[model samples]
Target: MDNINVSDPPARITTITSKKLSAKRAQTRIQAFLDDFENRNSTLKGGDKTVTVQLQKLNQALLDESQKRRKSAGEGR
Candidate 1:
């Protein structure tokens, strides 16, 4: 969980990263954030149009980050 700015409109949520953590620990952390994000996102989608659009942007940023990480990791291997 990082870059959480609820005060500002179009809050940004980015990928959860753990430095030097075990694979299991990293997975657990990511899963927890995703679960929480989904719950909140559901509510946002139902309530406000602007907020929903922000969530969509955040979602796409997350996906892009994940893809970048995976590609970099594969290159290292």
Candidate 2:
């Protein structure tokens, strides 16, 4: 039905806010760029920490967001 979006599989933008949308877009771009850079270089972990730093940053952001959501939920209930 309305929930079934065959065209855009995950329905990622269904309830996205402007700031979150921008963050998601930036994450996607950063991931793609990292993938391309790694593929091109093939030695991503030896002397360059670009990919590692990017991954750490993304992980930190996700962790922080999760913590914020959990704290808000606890406060509400």
Q: Say what the RMSD of model 1 is.
A: 9.4
Top TM-score: which candidate number?
2
**Whose lDDT is greatest here?**
2
lDDT of 1 by residue, 1-77 (tens): 68877887875888698468544455556666656766776864675557545655665666666778888999999
Q: Give the TM-score of candidate 1.
A: 0.40
Overall lDDT per candidate, in order of appearance:
0.65, 0.67
Tell me how far the alpha carbon of residue 18 in candidate 2 is from the true structure, in angstroms, after superposition: 20
True-structure RMSD, every candidate: 9.4, 14.1
The sequence of per-residue lDDT tens digits that candidate 2 reaches over residues 1-77 is 46666777563556555444544455566667767776776764467777667785895585567678778989998
* Candidate 2 weakest lDDT stretch, 10 residues: 15-24
